[model samples]
Target: MAVRKIEHVGVMVTDMERSIAFYRDVLGLETLGTLDHGNGTIKLAFLGSPGAGETQLELVQGYTGRLAEEGKVHHIAFTVDDLDAEIARIAKLDVTFIDPDITVLPNGARYRFFYGPDGEWLELFQPA
Candidate 1:
């Protein structure tokens, strides 16, 4: 059978509040709500843009430190209508860009990388 689109990306976060703020406030994603599992041993916050069936970013608590490593998932990317506008908005949050400047791929698509509150790699991609 053919596979459907990704439902969400599960991210392990060190600080639930900060991670939620980053995804909800900084990125401007809507909070779908939170979940308590394992009798409160685990906490998860679901976030996504406004609109039905959008892929969500799930932030899970109960982990310490970063989980991303080389040769791993690398980064989660989000599409932006205006990369420059998005960059300016994110700059107010004091987020550091991994690249000195946006990179243009061979196909002419533009992208830049940054880190989330829990040091999770994230990318902003603009199609050609």
Candidate 2:
């Protein structure tokens, strides 16, 4: 009930710089910024059209070098007004959560990962 919209779609990439360049140069999207995950092993870059309230494309690196059969599309993120409320609400559902606790990024954005019915990755994100 807390979800507002589809926030962003995460795409797994082997090279952050190259992926940023491709999204920027080829797709006409601007590089919003990049962040190093608290986990230390993962790097993330966000790209989107140069405007506010636009859906973004998140480039994720260092998750796993070997791509899975599901392909590079890592996860779908949904914007939530109240992450905690959504977490509590979703906990009653049958879906499985991938993260035990919410992850707060350096920029203050918070997120929690869960799984869809078909095992696809899903994220509930509250932006800073």
Candidate 3:
């Protein structure tokens, strides 16, 4: 068996509009599309960067089940060229940062954690 690459990451959100705005306005991601799930209850919105073939973010709404303490998934990380700049930009928003300061791995990669509109863990990672 062989796996190529991840198609997209799905996140559960309470409000579709709010989630779309947060991922769009705050994170600079564009909404690729949206649709009602065949189940007739869940609504999904797919978002992604402008570039072709970038991993997409899928927002799932109307999920009645309980979410884990962390969120829909453990966390979703976005690659950043300038972590400091991104940190400063997010600071001015009405978001919460999970990390007090940037964390540096042994390889010199740095990352910071923050919360999304629905309390989902989001991260900005800068490679060494």
What are the clash counts of all predictions, listed in order? 0, 0, 0
lDDT of 1 by residue, 1-128 (tens): 11134445667776889988887778888888776754577786878997865677878787444654552344576777677878878989999888899977544667678888988777776656
lDDT of 2 by residue, 9-125 (tens): 999988889888888889889888888997778999998887865689999898756776677899999999999999989899866999989999999999999999888899999
Clashing pairs in 3: none
TM-score-wise, the better of 1 and 2 is: 2
**What CA root-mean-square deviation does each model show from the true structure?**
13.8, 1.4, 13.3
Q: TM-score for candidate 3, please give it.
A: 0.54
Candidate of highest TM-score = 2
The true-structure Cα RMSD of candidate 1 reads 13.8
Q: Which order, best to worst by lDDT? A: 2, 3, 1
lDDT of 3 by residue, 1-128 (tens): 12134446678888999999998899899988887754658787879997866777879899788987566764676777788988888788866999899987554768788998987777787757
User: Could you tell which candidate, 2 or 3, scores higher by lDDT?
Assistant: 2
Global local distance difference test of model 2: 0.89
Stretches of candidate 1 above 4 Å error?
64-128
Minimal lDDT window, size 10, model 3: 1-10
Model 2 alpha-carbon miss at residue 58, Å: 0.2
| Pairwise lDDT winner, candidates 1 and 2 | 2
Model 1 TM-score on a 0 to 1 scale: 0.49
